[model samples]
Target: MRKSFFLVFLFMTLFVRTEAIRIVGSAPDYAGQRLEFFTVADPVSKTPVPFFEVTIDGRGNFTIEKQITQNTYCFADVGVYRGRMVLVPGKDVRITLPPLREKSFEESKNPYFNPVDIWLKVNEGNKKELTNLIARYDARFYQLTDTYFNQLYYRQMKNYLDTVRIRLEREFEKEEEPGYQTHRHLRMKSLEADLLRTGREKVAGSLQQLTPQEWTQPAFSDFLNRLFVNTLSTESKSAAGTRMKMWVARENLAELSKWTQDFTATEGSLSDLILLKMLHDAFYSGEFSSSAILRMVQSPWFSQNKEPRIREMAASVQKKLAFLQTGTPAPEICLPSSTGTIWCSGRNTKPFLYLLFADLEIPVCREQVRYLKTMAEKTGSKVEFLIVLSPSQKVNNTEFMSSNQIPGIMVTDTPNRKTGKEYKVRSYPSAFLLDGQHRVVLAPARTPLDGFEFQYTDLKK
Candidate 1:
């Protein structure tokens, strides 16, 4: 009885020790605003899963304690900055954010706003921490790349590449953390692939040996994503690619697994991951039939798969395959309008609906809004407009629409951009034309400024 009690105590103690990490920080410029920290769950989709959030006080101070089972790459998202760091288990981190630099109107409405990903500065007291070490390594790596860019990338100078690897190895030597080790290995391999212009098959040959634990490292999946970008387009030209095509056409998971074994050591999670990546790329590459790929991912095998990651990723990819296409049904959005009336998508009374994701505070979006107003007034109920705004846009949606005489339904998306994500709105002023049935007609329909009327006319007539 005493032994069992001791074992329980040990397990409970370990659970507490491994479960949570603490981050306390200050961002004077962003006081009173909410800051969110996230870790990438799947690199294929690169979707960040929020781990913690804290609203900064007036004094620009905040604290976050959240459960984290292992060391992981994480980032804090602010206005136009994404500060990145490595979070080590059981270690307390204190950081200071840079001064706020808000996104410009052009950037604010840009669906593809690439934030300046800077390293969060660890406090002086935590200068010797793992996150700081990773930041330093990254800084040195970039410096080396800048110094030898032409020679390493263009000239393929082995000496320069060797110098880089040697310096990095020497500086980060003796670090025994498995995540950190994987980071170093994968990062170096990425450089080797670039410098030698190695084929994807040769570069991917190393993946078969990586343990499942190693796959959890963000760096490994990131490298794999880079290695397989547009894989179908390249592979389709090869003889073996013909066999892959045949396997996918038949929706044969068994045959597909057999094919993947040629690249990976075993028919395991890693192989499945590579296969998923291929399917994702192929879905977009126009090399394979979309229906067939969708059916394959939705197969019963995915539901019965033992690996949770595979199942999760298959679901994510399946959603993309199902909705991101031009003809698929758009995700329903129900949001409160400026008039306090709930406005939901797919109940449009018109023959067509122009669904827009925009931020009225942005000049580009406002400009687009003006053009849309002019067009909507001229079209006169022939085309309904449903505009979704980001919560961060601090505008009186009612007053703005009233003053601007903006037509149709105007609503504010949730603070997390839930509706925007459902539509995969990456930039500002994204517009979609949907038929009465709510099926997408023109994904990313042209902006009014870009002669949208021409496209509309063709569709109308």
Candidate 2:
């Protein structure tokens, strides 16, 4: 009877030990496509761990079960798509990944893979799991690419490349033909290109021997070029010059330019608009004519939908230009100050008000105080210099006032703290100017106060 009880106890323990978490899902119409699964190391340590994977049967159903340690994390990757999840051992978890739509899976045609978008998306959900996954993938890719291809080091690039190639081949062997075939090929090609550029002759020869068909695949082409461009740009002699030349040579320049014009004209999404603005700033600054600006203003993207906010921005830009040229009255700033609430009346005798918010501990703040004192002495009639302290814990108002010899009415709106936010004072010693009518007369100034003066002489009609 005791022997029988021991056997039963052992059986129950085994059953509990074998219990697993199951992740099951079906692809959106998984008729032709096959699902692939794999796990990467925890990002930081590069330690290997078992992960669940399932390929859809003919019926479009896939179920992968993993026996996991409690609170352990793992990454799930499917073709170009990847996600991260944490598993509590003995509990089943279900995750339904949406179909791989063209919109969702589309890689940026930009030479850079632009990891920012992927990183942001991964980090948006389940931070701990995502962090571990990112660290793993980052380490893996770096090991695969940097260790093998980086030429600055004389270590055996071939050894690392060979290992990666063998691992990739084994992965290909396990995957179903023609479905995941393209993805594996692309990944290998990217790795090969990285190997070739390592300033190693043997690796370069092997890459050159690849067939025309292999070279022509879109995935392969995109991955190879991206790796090449990023690596070269990062490590090349005269990197800036090389990148500039490459940018000028790219066929997408016309498309990018047109897109910028359309987006600017139509007042598109803020994010899209910002990207176009940055591209324009990079390529067209100091080179684009006023005629070009006018052309951009007339593009369909700008013309089709006139957003009020965008219109306001354009008007504001025009106003800023006017101020730059002829010192037009700018925006009104009526925030509280340190001593008592001070309103810039704009009716002051001076043409401009040099409003500065400073922190006492900053050396730059001390220099600015000296500069303001000099300006007060020199441009006493032309500029009204006002210095405000950004109230801090370390600063004593009484001591600050006495030591700085601040001539203006020192003020603080402590409880509200509205002034700092209103002015967007991100750093100490930030300054802005106002016209005679308390209108903002100058652009937000971040640079040092020295050699900075405003004279609006040429106002555009």
Candidate 3:
């Protein structure tokens, strides 16, 4: 009996002594501050461990202790800035964060702020180096922004592009980077290529001054090719594959189409195929018709497979195309509210439902609320408006709703970003309009109705 008791006591003592690795960090005061901590069980797992919180002391020091049985990952998020750290069992960890200044819209008032700031900080106080870095980074950033802008806001982006070109030319003349002569030749060649594509003769004088060597560099040639291909593809949506499409069109469309069909039939990766299909839909579909897009999405090919990534894309495509088709019911939205709880269903509502996700601190959302108030007056309760608060937001949803005289139901999705993901709302001031059946009618209502001076007739018609 004593031998058995001794063995049990030994096991209990080992269990009692078990302790986890501790992580400690300090955050410096810079603007409004809070440190967010998150951990993942493994590198492959995308989902973070729930119910973990980093404890912060009054002095800005924080600690996170976990009995890590396996490899664990952690990260600190302060505002928009993020830093990652990892800890293993039996390891001591400490992290120090650099003070980060809060970003402000006022900084954008200076036209050269981005270029000059990058030049000064990253280029080691070298004027020439700064200029070169700015040119490259700006070009890349604008290219990315422009690609998305064309699909969303083409005219506005075109006007911005013109302004950017003018700024680029003005800056190019003053730039004194080493190899100025060679760089200038390359720069002028690129500018000429771009201008020629624009079909503008105004820059003909500048184009005439380029050297032969400037046009031969592989980098310059590659850039020209990509720019031309992108421009052509944008001009003609029917062009599906990048290089393959060009080659196929030059050879034979029937053969190319058959090959693509066969490849898709094999069905290696549904996600990749769906992505290609989305691109195809964007390019080949002449105009946005709900029925046509819906039919393409609901075909057997899309429904046959089930993968998380594919499902997400399929849902997104469906939301974008057939959100408000007749006979379809609207998605149910039930969330917690300060008073108790609020629910929004298409059932029992007049034929229209307006859902708004607003951040009280955002000026754009504030303006949108005023427009909504006006809309409510004009609609005269014909429309139902629901405002949902983001969980991470600190503003009192009730106070904001009451003060704004917002007419719809107010709800909050606490702790979980379920509502946001359901609607695919990544940014603030997102709004959706659903038909009476609770089906999505108008999604991605990004443009404020007020900004456009939208009248009641717009929605009614």
Candidate 4:
């Protein structure tokens, strides 16, 4: 009986260790605020997938737990700053946030604004842990780089770089954790790349030699992304680039992959990844046919790739490019009005659906909505005007619409901001026009203040 009890205890301990990563933290200055933790789902896009949110209590204490199988990078938006940390499976982390510094109105409204990234204070962590090791190594690396920037860059001091590299290697030599090993190796390589002034082709050659799979590591992906930034623009001008464009034009995945391998001197899965990067980057560049690239992503070559990561990433790419473009089907929006009636885009009665996402708190959005009333009055039955509101905006919608004579259906998105995210609505007054079949006609269909009346008149012709 005693032996069985001990075995049971050990098993339970192991199960707990392998199952969850718990974070216990405090932000005394931000009491009652909710902090959402995010992890990268698709490394190439670096899209932040929200894992969980914890609300700080009156005392500014919060605890959250998430299931994970490996060391995962996690971050939380604390006011205008993003606090980041590496979470190890089975280990509990205790941290303290810095003082709250909220975002200004303009910053909050800016869609392209990024939060300042800062390392959270790990109040409870062993020095041998990957998080601690990485933090220490980065600090030293930054110090060394700062101390010898000019000497390394213009002076071409190989001896100085060697000294820095040796110091970093010696200090971190004992870290056997696979994640730490990859991070250290990539950081050292990046340092070498900088000091040696390695050209893009040489970096590409070095990337080809790297162990083919390190997609999960932030360091590896960072290096990969930096090396391939704007590759489409640069490569398309090359002699090989013309053939690559032809392959993409034909929606030929096989030839595309081959082109990538030939151009970069990389083989197999690495070349496939590089090609995906190129396709993803070029999607918004207007350098290639977006529709053709979208078809290639949805092709069987990617969907049935032998590598699971490639399949997953390709699916991610497809989802991102699927909507919001001209001729693509608009994302369905079915929301409830204050009067309890459900309004859906599919049930539109007009030949065209004019969808408007507006926040009343924003002056510009309010101005546009007023302009919309005039436009709606003139359109007659040819167009259906729909307005989406944020959940936080609490007003007598019926009174406001009636007062403004805004002839439109008003609906508020749920607290999750689902509609806004689906429409990729970042600013206060984003608008889209959909056709009779709910296909996107004008991606950002011009706002009423921006001569959308003339644009719509022309479209009606």
What TM-scores do the predictions have? 0.81, 0.40, 0.44, 0.86
- Give lDDT: candidate 3, residue 413: 67
The residue ranges of model 2 lying beyond 4 angstroms of the native Cα positions read 1-132, 149-278, 283-299, 302-335, 340-350, 409-428, 437-441, 444-449, 452-461
Quantify all predictions' global Cα lDDT against the true fold.
Answer: 0.77, 0.46, 0.50, 0.78
lDDT of 4 by residue, 217-303 (tens): 778777777677668777788876787788778888887777677666677667777778888888878899989988888888778
Best prediction by lDDT:
4
Best-to-worst lDDT order: 4, 1, 3, 2
Query: What tens digits encode model 3's per-residue C-alpha lDDT throughout 170-202?
Result: 656666533344444544444344544353222
- Find the candidate with the highest TM-score and give its number: 4
Name the runs in model 3 displaced over 4 angstroms: 1-77, 82-232, 235-332, 335-348, 362-364, 371-373, 389-406, 411-430, 444-461
**lDDT at position 238, candidate 4:** 83
For candidate 3, what is the lDDT? 0.50
What is the Å distance of residue 12 in model 4 from its true position? 18
Error of 2 at 243 (Å): 19
Q: Which 10-residue window of candidate 4 scores lowest in summed lDDT? A: 196-205
Residue 143 lDDT, candidate 2, scale 0-100: 67
> Tens digits of per-residue lDDT for model 2 on 206-324?
34333332332334334433432232223224534454334434523344444433422322333223322333333224333333443443345434425443343333333322342
Report the error of model 1 at residue 154, Å.
3.4
